[model samples]
Target chain A: MKIGIIGGGAVGLLFAGYLGQKFDVTLIVRRELQLQSLLMNGITVHKGGSSFTTRVDSDLLTEVSMKFDFVIVAVKEYDLKPLEKVLELMDKNQPLLFLQNGIGHLEWVESLPHHNLLAGSVEHGALKENDHVLHHLGVGKTNLALIKGEWGAVEELVSQSIPSFPFLLKQDFEEMLLTKLFVNVLINPLTALTRVRNGKLVENPHLHQLQRDLFQELLLLYPHMERNVSFEGVVEICNNTYENRSSMLKDIESERKTEIESILGVLLEKAQREHHFVPIMNVVYRLVKGIEREGLGG
Target chain B: MKIGIIGGGAVGLLFAGYLGQKFDVTLIVRRELQLQSLLMNGITVHKGGSSFTTRVDSDLLTEVSMKFDFVIVAVKEYDLKPLEKVLELMDKNQPLLFLQNGIGHLEWVESLPHHNLLAGSVEHGALKENDHVLHHLGVGKTNLALIKGEWGAVEELVSQSIPSFPFLLKQDFEEMLLTKLFVNVLINPLTALTRVRNGKLVENPHLHQLQRDLFQELLLLYPHMERNVSFEGVVEICNNTYENRSSMLKDIESERKTEIESILGVLLEKAQREHHFVPIMNVVYRLVKGIEREGLGG
Candidate 1:
């Protein structure tokens, strides 16, 4: 089985390294430096104080000409627009899996004429240390669900998953993505704005109050979310990832672009469509954008 | 007339230096270091390219035994609780003026037996360079209004104002404080949370959107405020103080206690009493308090 992962980021690297153990994996990258490094030294993933290298075929995103059995789009949601044409040009029968954060891309993906489409929520915490090196911090499994077409491709990947790296097939894609979005919406922007570690969100009483308020706002849109994902579950995530800075917070500190638009931006649009007032989310959404604008010199 | 100024902060020093030029001013400070420095070097006002030194009397707040015809309480609103007993022991006829931010202190001041009570909004921009030197940045006048008193002491102070430091008498105290509160509520927390200067609130479009949302929330409680304080006026203040870091921002950077409780806390209480929904205010309020907790090791 041939699997192609588009994005040389942390998630893409982790997927390529783990999936390469069982299948032919190709890393499609845009940056020439990352492509050269990946082709020359291969991908190395560090987990539990041990590191292993996996050799995989690499190609520049612009020069990718080979067809794959399954392709995973792992780039950020904001970065998905530029690759829409590339994804469209692929074979219609080829199954495509999107591993981006937030459900904002679902609408864009629905517009594509692909026969088999899959959406995934990556629960594993992976950090890119260098061009070809990744640090796998958490051992959480990737949850995959069918967005459109048959689940044949998703089942094949789940059945062939490597040891210590697991893939779980979920029935409902929207619920899976919404659960991830709920956690991201509550944790990412607040942690970014406060510039604190994840644990501080629940540990600090005032921040906890703000988080609860944000949770209440989210519940207004999807009242059933309270049952599936309790407020305590969100707090537990913060406590479990106690010492790690959120991706949004890291982006702000490093002056990199954040995925806030993919997260809170989409949530706000949904709230507006439903005529539900989510003032707390609105405030945080604008604040993260403002901070991003200031950091990115926009 | 003899005047006593309590609290040796920037506002206290600014008041003593200017008011000393026209009256016998005694700077009563809590810090022994500030008291000693004031007694030795007096108070120096640095404005523009020139500087002026005013030799005012100095006394420790705990050791002060002298009586004054009038007194100016220049401490922060949060610091007012500890001074309540001391304020009660002052001469009953001695008119007291509060130079603090927020209207939270109004109720406490009204309970005093003093014959006259005044609330003044200090518009001048003063930075404490040291224990004895202050940099007067903006030359705005102080707006004084009678809270609960005969206007005898206020009229005397206005009638005998010093040069370049003007004092204007306002008829409505609530209106005057609310106007100032409107600006502080909009500017202080946003700038502090973003760690940007005052101008960024209006300059960054995203931050500006958040500021507008906050303005709308405030207007919901005081609908008449739309007539008195225009949203543009708040933006103008941000533009005018473009390079200045708000006091709350400075406090956060320095790891000092912020006035979040006095400003947003008081506003939240009022919002609760009125049953008004101010979600944005609630979020920023708790975020600032959380940051304060993390910074101050609370």
Candidate 2:
């Protein structure tokens, strides 16, 4: 089955770069500059000292070429609506997988009458160098679990295309998605507001206590959640991701609307609906909202 | 009557610059460079945007051309012993004024059987520009208090010299020294370690609460003690010197052996002596000691 990747940022381009060689792939980038640049320089995937560039066709994304077997949305969470309208034009039988950090996408897509949407999580610290360039600063597993059917075929494709990196096909979809959401809520808002790196948290006892506070509050609200499998038993991922900017931190640093809206923002709403008090998360949400209201990211 | 000024640092040089006009003065500096610089260029007082330079003989200190009627020891409190040895060569009938912050000078000088040791408190923020130059940043007041016999003549002389600025004839020498000690404990450690200016304290609520905790703890131990005096209703003299760097901050920034040993270190010792646990001060002392041990200033 042919795969079509939507969005042309690091996440989108990296996926297209990695999956292009194994399958029939076309990268759907919105801007003419991105398309032109990709056509000229290809897409650079930098890992360690090695780098590779891949060719992508932008024209295949128009409603005319909406024939792919799978569609992956790779934009920041707030930019999902316009592309969701475009995804409306695609074949409804094809599976849709979201590779964003936050939980709102699952809710948004689930609200629509789509039969084949998959909740996915990528802990990969993929950083965008430029319009058509990327850096994989950290290697986190890509978990793809179907909300409806078995992911055996997807697993086969992933196993065939695996490049010495970890990928997973888990059956417990909602809990897996919630676990990733828990990790995002705990780390992203904290690192964003405090302007500290992953390594710096352990240096300050106050911040370490803050991390535990967020964990306790999240656990109290969503007790059914499993610890983040990527970061849970594997205790060293946080230290390893030292000095590497979280995408939310990068958003705040670059003066862009952060994924806090999808992560903590939606969780706050859900907590209110469930009649639960999350003091720690409420603090993070309010601070980020104040930052956004001040036109900080505008 | 003749006077002798000890230490070639800014404090000694500044007093020498002004007091040289008032009395026949001799400045004793340890370093040959400082001694030669003062002898060649004269002590320059950069006060109120105008420069006043005054010349004094270098050999008069040892040549015994005149006997000292007053001696002002203005070195860092740590180097008190050399001044003690120098005192052996001087006339024993003179009154000595200590122009240093913190409380240990009283104990050290009290150990000597001198004729009279008058305690003086100067809140002037001065920086050593060069060996022979001093920059007086802020002008608060110098309070001269007599610790021994007949305060009548000394008070009149100090009152007549600076009738314009706020100078006090503080009879309560112990209270006056303790007042300066208490204020330095708060202002110096907070500003220097945090590397924050006085006004910047208002920006962070966390830091503000920490200040409150420290203040409240000090209040618990010493009830009804008000070091916070106002020329017009303001408590801290530090607020008057807002933009100026505290001497403690300058010491830390310049990587010098801090007066922390005499300041907070003495406070901790005093608290232990009184059998009362100063929780906040203990924390501050430990934190500063940790900073000193870590060579953070380096």
Candidate 3:
């Protein structure tokens, strides 16, 4: 199987290295420097204090002209609009997998001409150390659900997955995405605003109370969220990633646009539509949006 | 007229310097170092481009004795509990004017034996420069209203007020305090949590909308708040104090206990009692409280 991954963020590099192990994978990086480096030395992934380099084909995003069995859209939500032309040019039968953080891209994905669509929530913690070096901080399962089209395409893609970078098939699309969204909504913005690591929210009594309140209020919107995921499970995730700064926090520090709109922004709109009162969420939404508008992040 | 001002924070020092111009005023400060300096150099007031020094009487809070016409309690709400013994020692008949930021001190003041009670909403912006110096940043009036006292006592107190620090008497106590409380509730906690100056709350579009939502929600509890204060007035206050850091923001920066409980805490309690929903306030309250617990402030 030949796979082409678009965009060269941490997630893009991570997918390229792992999928390159078994399948014919080509990484379409936006930066020329990163593409040159990957072409010269291949993609290097660091995990468990050991480093492995995978010889993956590389090309600039604009230079990619060949057909592939699948294309994984691994860019941020804000970066989605600019890729409309690229996505429109792709083959309708070639299944496109999206790995964005929030559910904000659902409407846009539905509008695309692609008939075979799959959405994924990446649990793996990947950070880009440089242009070509990707650090796989934690090993977590990537859950994939079919947003539209048949599951036969997904089965073909799954057969190519290696044991190390495992992908799990979820039955429900909304539940799979909502579970990840709920956790991200509760954790990311708070850590980014407070500029603290994940564990501090659960370790500090007052912060913990806030987390409880925010979680309780969020559950009101999707009470079924607890059926699939427990409050303890969310806290456990925070404890496991205790020392790690959340991606939202890292984006704010690096002055990159955050996925707040896809995360908290979508939730706020839903609250308004449902006419449900969520005070805690409203405050956080405004605060994060305020920081973004004030040029802390675009 | 003679008066004793308790607590040597910005408010206490502001009252001491202004009232010292006309009345035989004595400042009761907690710090022995501040007492020694005030004793040696008197109280200095810096306003506009000019500066003036007044020979005001100074004494340690532990050593305050003799009879005074009235005692003005100019301390934070958190500091009120520790001063129970000091308040008990004062003459009960003497009018005690309490100048606090929030409505949290309302219950504590009602528990005191003083029948001649008054409340004042201080509008002036004062910053403590040193042990004995205070810079008066803005010229605004002090609105006083009788909480449990006759107009005779307030008349005597107002007569001694200087022109720069004029005191204006209002008819209703709740209306007077609630107006100031409304502005404070909308500004203080948000600024402190975001670590921005007072003006940023209004200047930032997202923050301003959130402020509007919180203000609209808080008004349900006290519908009469807008009769004396307009929403524009609160925005004006933010614009006027654009460069000045709020006392709450300053407290958080200095790692001292913030006045959040006194401000937002009281409103949250009232929301519970009245069954009025205040979502944004609840979230901001928890965040500020969390930061306080983490010892960014007490």
Best by TM-score: 1
Order of models, best lDDT first: 1, 3, 2
lDDT measured at residue B125 in model 1 versus the true structure, 0 to 100: 91
User: Each prediction's TM-score against the native?
Assistant: 0.94, 0.61, 0.90
Q: What value does the lDDT take at residue A146 in candidate 2?
A: 81
Q: Which segments of model 3 are wrong by more than 4 Å?
A: A20-24, A33-56, A148-164, A205-210, A216-220, A253-255, A296-298, B40-50, B53-55, B150-157, B296-298
lDDT of 1 by residue, A1-298 (tens): 8889999999999999999888999999999999999989999999988999999999999999759998999999989999988988899989999999988889989889999999999989988999999999977889999989987666788987886889888889999999999999989999999888999999999999889988999999999877778999999999999988888998999989999989998888899999999888988888889888888885
Indicate whether candidate 1 or candidate 2 has the larger DockQ.
Answer: 1
Q: How accurate is candidate 2 locally (lDDT)?
A: 0.69
Q: What global local distance difference test value does model 3 have?
A: 0.85
Q: Per-residue lDDT for B229-282 in model 2, tens only?
A: 322222245456657666776876676767887787776777788887665565
Candidate 1 — which residues are off by over 4 angstroms? A152-156, B151-156
Task: Give me the candidate number with maximum lDDT.
Answer: 1
- Per-residue lDDT tens digits for candidate 2, residues A1-298, read 5787888887888788777757777788777778788888878899999988877656434543777778777777888887766777776777777787767777677775556778778878788888889997787778887877445346656777666456788777777778778777767776665556765544555455566656777777777663433335322555778677677778776776777788987788888999987756764565455444333511
User: Candidate 3's residue-wise lDDT over B1-298, tens digit each?
Assistant: 7888998888998899888888889999999999999999988999999999988898888999937888888998889899989889888888888998888888888889987899999999889988889999978999998888665555876876677789998888788888888888888887887767778888898889988888888778788776777878899999998887888888777777888888888888888998988777777877777777666532
Q: Which candidate do you rate higher for TM-score, 1 or 3?
A: 1
lDDT of residue B278 for candidate 2: 68
Q: Tell me the deviation in Å of residue A9 in model 3.
A: 1.9
